[model samples]
Target: HKGQELVMADIPGLIAGAAEGVGIGDRFLGHIERCRVLLHLVDASLPGPVEQWRVVREELAAYGGGLENKPEILALSKVDLVTPQALAAKKRALEKASGQHIYTVSAATKQGVEPVLDKLMEIAGRAQAMKVESDKSWSPI
Candidate 1:
């Protein structure tokens, strides 16, 4: 718990046709263009969580505003509703599908939430450090 602060914004839900100006459209994609990382919260309790993840990824790629290239953390929400076996299965499936670590969290119980936040902060800190380094002009004083 260092003295680092991470800011997160809540954007509108993206639909299947969001890239085509459907269901809130891709207008909000620009809002996160500069963001160093993205937390993609997926409902694990529902069916086809992997498919849902792909749909969002597709929309981001279609929008084409650097969103598709941003680092993303896949978070599986509502794990409490599913059994341990089911949760593990979904997590593995999602991990294989996205090729990224899958964080399981239950907002209702606050389970596995802190680790996600900590990971995000760690990523943001690194990104900030890189930005600072790149922003500096080498001065041989």
Candidate 2:
């Protein structure tokens, strides 16, 4: 928003063996190294949603390169497909497992999207600022 631009790359869903060049994981994971932030969207309609989230995290940790340390905005996608009770349970499980606030969103209904984007913008802005500060610090004194 504003005069600045923030681009979000839609990377493929990472599988278990992604860190070892399984499927297209290694290639895409490499691209993630240069990213300022990671927006991890979990498909709430799927079975074992928390496991899905963990798998991606495991792959990123295995990939190394400080990928595990990157700032992650965890979101629950496809919320429109699940019932209110299921959604609430998923939220609790995901939040407890990931230890982060989970943003529930449905692109089809456009529900809970703006708040997520606003949070993303704030995080990205701070990340960009830190990078610029770090870049300026790399000087021989």
* Predicted model with the maximum lDDT: 2
Error of 2 at 69 (Å): 0.5
Residue 57, candidate 2: how far off, in angstroms? Answer: 0.1
Alpha-carbon TM-score of each model against the true structure: 0.91, 0.95
> How accurate locally, in lDDT, is each candidate?
0.88, 0.93
Q: How accurate is candidate 2 locally (lDDT)?
A: 0.93
lDDT of 2 by residue, 82-126 (tens): 999999999999999999999999999999998888888888999
In the order shown, the candidates' Cα RMSDs to the true structure are 2.5, 1.3
Across residues 1-141, which tens digit of lDDT does each residue of candidate 1 receive? 567677898777788988888877577777878789999999999999999899999999998977888888889999999999999999999999889999999999999999999999988888888889987966768
Spell out the clash pairs found in candidate 1.
none
